[model samples]
Target: MTPDDQPFRPISVFTDIAIEARDIVRGDAHQEIPGVRVEEHQARGVRVTEVEIFEESAERLMGKPRGHYITLDVPTFKERDPELRQRLTGMLTDQLKTVIPQDPQKSILVVGLGNWNATPDALGPRVVDRILVTRHLNQIVPEDLRDRMRAVAAVAPGVLGTTGIETLDMIRGIVDQTRPDVVVAIDALAARNLDRLLGSVQIADTGIHPGSGVGNRRQGLTETSLGVPVIAIGVCTVVQSISIAQEAVQLLVEELAEDVTLYKILREMTPAEQRGLVEEVLGSRFQDLMVTPKEIDVLIDDMADVLAEALNRALQPQLDRQEWT
Candidate 1:
């Protein structure tokens, strides 16, 4: 059958899925989960949830040693709210700073987890790109202004490259060379749903898997494997195609482009126009297979900046408290 002979395609929309606190695994006394009163929901196809299990919420939590493990559900570039994103960043930063160890001479190893070439899985690389990497600062800035930061290095392990090094091996080598205080890993994650494209960022004290984005799970990067404490931060960037279809429908409900607004405009459209504009734009091509417009690049940049800031803030206190005590 010819293209025009095909019937009008039906659009699919995705919505939030919900979860309760009782269903999630709880951390041990020493391995506690922070920000409890846990709840779960879905956005797009990404799982959205919140928890508050910190042992010391208002007291030494900020001053004492601790770790942060978090995950965020951000569904779309077009849908992200700047204010909400910043607020989440700030909360994660505050919690992480409270738990990180303080020591000026101590070092930190950061791993950017995920494949860089894929846009949906590039959150890890994008975050590391914006970091104030301490190791490189000495070459660019005067020694006096370098602050108390002892050392910092960022790495992204290629999944199939000839490098042939495992995530654990790379981190172990860094730990052996630097003997740093801690390690922080940033990675992209799969949510049960698809809505969390850019609206959330999660931070956790536990370890991480390097190539979880593409479903290649090797040995995980955690404290036990490297003999060093590990903290993980992640954002859910991909979701189900059904959710994408839903978002497109919502967009049409509120606004219409001048060219496509008129049923008359649509009436006059040729087969080529229908296929190029309405059918494609409102179909899976816009939602699933492609990255849509160029503005999404900006959204990724913003997410990277927010994550980097949160990581830096979490580490700043350790930089400050290093020599004092």
Candidate 2:
């Protein structure tokens, strides 16, 4: 594509860090960013894509930098296949272990970041409910038996609307009191593509800025801010309505490209221009809207179970996979 044909600005709509990185690495936009690396792997039926941003320069280009983003692209996270579930959980746990500092006995605090009352945003709280917290057990059990379990703590800090407190502030207080070695934060993310919604999970070593999915960015939870390593895990639960419309418009453009009369007019317009036209037609009211599947309730529950099982297995290495069930 020519310079005019290429999008002039980075698509600011997507919230999933991996998707943003993929767009850059694919030369879709910002091809000048340096020190970006990408690798792909497969585990059974799962497709794993790793995108590493190694420098601040690339970070400026992609909007997220200096972190390792691992994306698990599963066809459907709600599948009933036991073997597929086992493989997916194993893959997720393995990714979590890599980011977490090596200390099987270390104290970990898993912060579930979301509003439990909303199904689309309830992935974090649900996962927190399913986690096998051993902090209390460690205090009561003898040292011999306690060694079998890790000191893991979990909390579902509700959104600012319900609690009237910054989620970061509450987490900071808990971090100071519990003094955990690491923190694992989970939340639901927004995707630019409908295909990725409820079909992918992203894990990052660089912390997370909660509420970014819906454009309400809050103070980020990071090692620099919290004084401990922060691993963020999230699944894309929704996509912006404007983005969906843009995709549909692009498909229509492609289908009409072959027409002799439309070819010249369409060829003169860039993808960005086409998207602008679509947005103009959609109007401002629909631009701010977000879209999620009607079955988001069921999807969130299944994802929470999968993520919780993975976290439990990774935190407590001594426990067998079957023990999670």
* TM-scores of the models, in the order given: 0.58, 0.90
> Looking at model 2, which ten-residue stretch has the lowest summed lDDT?
24-33
- Give the top-scoring candidate (lDDT): 2
Best by TM-score: 2
Screening candidate 2 with a backbone cut-off below 3 angstroms (N, C-alpha, C), the clashing residue pairs are none
Candidate 1 residue-wise lDDT, 181-245, digit = tens: 78888776544334455555666565776544334556877788888888777766555453345
Taking the tens digit of each residue's C-alpha lDDT, what string does model 2 give over 124-164? Answer: 99999999887888678767667777888999999999999
TM-score, cand. 2 vs. native: 0.90
Model 2 lDDT, residue 207, Cα: 91
Q: After TM-score superposition, what is the CA distance of residue 26 in candidate 1 from its true location, in Å?
A: 14
